[model samples]
Target: MHSDGNRKATIARHRVRLAACALLAAAAVLAGCERGSQIGAGESTGGPSGCPAVLAGAQAAVSRAEKKEVFWNGPTTGPAAAPGKTIVYVAQTMTNPGVAGAANGVREAARVIGWNVRVIDGGGTPAGIQAAMSQAVAVRPSGIVVGGFDPDSTSQQVSRADAAGIPLVGWHAVAAPGPSRRPELFTNVTTRVEDVAGISARWIIAHSHGRAGVVVITDASIPFARHKSDLIRKELATCSGVELLAYENIPIPDASSRTPQVIASLLSRFRSRWTHSVAINDLYFADAAAAFRAAGEKGSGPPFNIGAGDGDPSAFQRIDDRLYQAATVPEPLSQQGWQIVDEFNRAFSGRPASGYVAPVHITTAGNSDGATTWDPAGYREAYRRIWGK
Candidate 1:
């Protein structure tokens, strides 16, 4: 009777152990499926799960970009101003602060350089941009500034300009800044998009301590803007804990109307999970602020925001006030504007492009010192001296 009892007890214990093992296996499979679902929509499996190494590197990079005292290291020697030259600025839209800011710089420089400058607004449409480019080419200006729009979209106009020997310069018009052979730009004026993208992503990583649920906003209509957002997405993926919650595509023209609605939807769906946001341009945050306020989000934010490029005055104000935007990787719009005019001077004198790319900088309220724009020092004087004005 004792042996039969011992055998029955042993069988019962073995069955319980088997049941526990089966339950663990089922949990493991379910967890993997959940991860698989997350990854199907642009999630990353790279980097260490906790991202200790990545977090340290990101913190260091953000430290470098946040410095306030930046000096200009642009071309000090170039052809003196090509005087009396007429240049027309073909704008993507005057409403875009970056474009207008750069245009203002061009006017400032042109006044010193003794050149005539005209602006033709593109209205932020392909047709509108093409019309502007056509008008610019028809006016037969000494040069054409492709301000904040793709040159390829207006290929015929670009080709016409090239054929007519009118030098073309682009501001935020290409992926990389410098001379291009295929699209045929004298040089593109802007910060390196990769640097902009990386630092913005690193800002989020450092700010969040490697754990964040991020939403990336971009305008898919412009090639430069689209490429910038794509780079931002890739950099965000470097930290395994930084989950990309959504990639929103709201065109710049439609942003004012569309962004509020989109932000409402995102808030409803993601709620507390969306811990941070980044946009290719700062204006999205401008549009998003109202929606956030309506939903009772704080003037400060759980979804701390950053703009990847084009640090306009409004963006700086937003950062300084801490009204939803925390930081910006601002292009020296005014400096780049001066650079654009200088590049045209070089082109007119039959010289090669200046090959000067601005260093990336990040602006936050603590570092802003009540400034409304990120206008670095010394570039204006440097360009003036080069132009011998």
Candidate 2:
């Protein structure tokens, strides 16, 4: 009886061991299947799965419009000005490099045309802009140029200028979807905000191979920033595999202090899934890239960053170093400044102001080795010839 019991116990133990091994094999197969499903979920054996058609369409559209230049072919002689006549430029802020560059362009053109020019610093505040506009009207300059000031805040002053028969020209001032409602506004020299956002989105998608999980950093205080953010959201919606993990609107005042925190928080939360960062401009992208490096996240395949406008020098350096920045779409800021002068000249001459679409170009680490901004082909000569400088 004891021998028989031992034999039965040994058989039962073997049976249990065989069952456990089978279960382990089953679990391994199940795990492998799960991984396979994940890998194939948004990709194909042939190529990327999500939004292939959309990607191709975007590429075609960009290709169709790539590097198309617009030049001013109006009368060579700008409106003749009396020796003492003056032009007033209401700068957004002299402190801003881009605004300062525009001011310089205005100054240069005014110098060539023998017109006195005064630039009032708007101090980047509504009150300052209003004050500047009021002061400009008091002086009764030949014309007025505004650099990215809020039109509504200065509407009354704009009305006053119109009543006083002063032509107002804006550079980088008009928001997207604008021919300013204020009839006093003569024209705006700017690129379509949507186009800038769209091109940037396309670059992200293409470079990431159509699988972009993006974090968009926007500045709500700036109308152009909001416009760019909105358009980027719209474009990315059409892309299937692209997910918008966060749409962070960093107020202009807090951007310097808040950017690092924002980037760190988002990286920690979405490090595995996030693949790109799209910022309103290069300034924010630089901050994000620095934060990424500080956090010890190493590798460059996904989570690339890109931006639009101003082409901050630091951003170009980041791209060169291959830290995280991938590309930047630079608006021809200085050239736009010259265009502002040309438009004002046209208005002063009683000719209809020809609003020129500012040109933009995508600069990568590869293409932007020695450059930080986009200058249209022969832009200097073209403007000089037009202004008869």
Candidate 3:
């Protein structure tokens, strides 16, 4: 009787184990089916595929005033420069076209107003930025504009400027989380990064018909790049038919050598599953398109690419040539330069700084036939008028 009872217990335990295994298998199958349903329901407006329509409506709702022509309307009197007053522009790096363009803008505006202006190159390093800031502080310029350098890195120099009654303005230096509220830093002039990401995502979704399998290329080293990447991820989340296969963060230091390998690996892993690629800027996506060509895996149809920030000439050429690059959102660098000087003028004149939002526009093959950057004719005229030039 005891042996029979023991044998029955063993059989009961075996039955329980089998039941558990069956339940596990069923759960796994259900999860996969749910994922597949989301992907296949491309026509459903309530699902991920519905993102394009939502984005379209939102974009259309942008105020007519905001979308209106870019123009300057600051204090008409402008700032009264102190005797022998000079303005200094500290650039993150002259190597970057955007930074260089900004430097030129400062010079142009200063020339119009007849104020002495100087620019210092920071060499794109923390130490270099600190050193440049130190040099500028020692000279005791009327005001200082810093391009693409983190405010925290040069806090000491910024404090010195503040103590000396010189206002400091930052361009592309502050990120989201809040405005430039630091006492030493007056204000930041920058494009709406969130809008740049949102518009680029919307473009991809609309062009791909919402069936986009996207691979995101992000640069974690730069705060603004990460900001753009984060916004892209958030915006794409609303699209049901869009699958995020991967988010690859490539540090700028190793980007030249690592990007190709990273792109090749993504191609190998996802194969033809992915239908689109988005990046922080044209720099990364342009290189990615080249990698696809070199690998001889350039497939025909619909998994195109897009990016944000500087509208590189090479990127425009690629778009015009019908390459994988589809579009780029260009932040008006020269306009920001003019705005930076304008803000400083207001501050010096004891008026509130005019926190200007730089204009951005999408450049594609159709619209950018011969344009590397958006034309600033209207804004330039407006600024000239305000300055009584």
Candidate 4:
């Protein structure tokens, strides 16, 4: 009887061990099944689960796009205060539309990046610019943005600014031999003046059927005048019988001596002989276009081709009135200011302080169904998508 009882007890112990082994295997299978479902879902959704590295980079790029109406490339965004930083923008340009346009860009850029800006209008004199820069430097601002100023007069101020550890940026134009001028003050942004000139010349040539003439009105004091004037001549050189009748430079605030009518009269004389006409920037074309229309000459002389470098509302109005023809380049002043702010934000965030060019294009009545103007609002949503919204 004792031997039989011992055998039964051993069988019972074996049965319990077998049951525990079966339960352990089932739990392992269920856990593995749950894990597999999670992996599969993450892959399908392309969310946090499937490819985390790729998703993270894509999200970052999307944030960089902003809400501003873009005239140039890239959306404008309100960057959170990345780091403690302060910057001062100094245009220091006297009454020049090009400078004004640049200032507008700088202002917009500042608003985006959250920086302070100090605008100084530098009359067509080096002394004035020097004084303006000196005053700005005295405050020891983080950085200064100058609009194509010749630093000769501002040498002392620039040197002082460097000593004080302030950085400088040039907008629109930089001093000649710019590299040597201010190693400390590097980086400049200007619309592609040559590109605009090329477009102007080509439009004239196209409108004239290869017969064209040029009358470039410019401000001799501004750096843009000579550089752009040279480009006009170069591009016109590409077409036969296309000639520059006169390259005139009229000073701002002194247009009284050379009224738009007077300039127009000068151009009119050449128009009778040549089939086309053009100007260096907005003022030139606006005035010339007015002169031609007031004279009751519509398409009378070579399509009255003119190129406006900055697309101001007044310029567009003139275009709408059919007082002007040819193409106008859109350099939204507000958008430029916003880009400056964007760059500043990057620098403050310890990213590259690399300079960037905001892309621009030629806007004409043809592009907008003969509207003869650019209303950025029509494409605001699209602009926001690229620039910021």
- Top-TM-score structure, candidate number: 1
Summarize candidate 4's per-residue lDDT along 55-76 as a digit string, tens digits. 3332342223212234433433
Task: Report lDDT (Cα) of residue 384, candidate 4.
Answer: 35
lDDT of 1 by residue, 1-389 (tens): 99999999999999999999999988765564331123211122232345888988988998888899999877889898887899999999997888999999899888889999999999998999999999999999999999999899999999999999999999998899999987999999989999999999998888877777899999999989999999999998988889999999999989999999999999999876777899999999999999999998875676889999888999999888879898899988888888889999999999999999999999988789998888678988898889888
Please give the range of 10 consecutive residues that has the lowest summed lDDT in model 1: 35-44
TM-score for predicted model 4 compared with the true structure: 0.67
Span of 10 residues, lowest total lDDT, candidate 3: 36-45
Q: Cα lDDT for residue 339, model 2? A: 70
Candidate of highest lDDT: 1
Q: RMSD for each model, in Å, please?
A: 6.1, 7.3, 9.0, 27.1
Tens digits of lDDT, candidate 3, 5-72: 99999999999999999998887655533322322112321224445566454345222212424454
Worst 10-residue stretch by lDDT in candidate 4?
39-48
Model 2 residue runs over 4 Å out of place are 1-47, 61-85, 94-97, 176-179, 298-302, 312-314
Q: lDDT of candidate 3?
A: 0.69
Ranking by lDDT: 1, 2, 3, 4
For all predicted structures, in order, the TM-scores are 0.88, 0.79, 0.77, 0.67
The CA lDDT at 73 in model 2 is 42
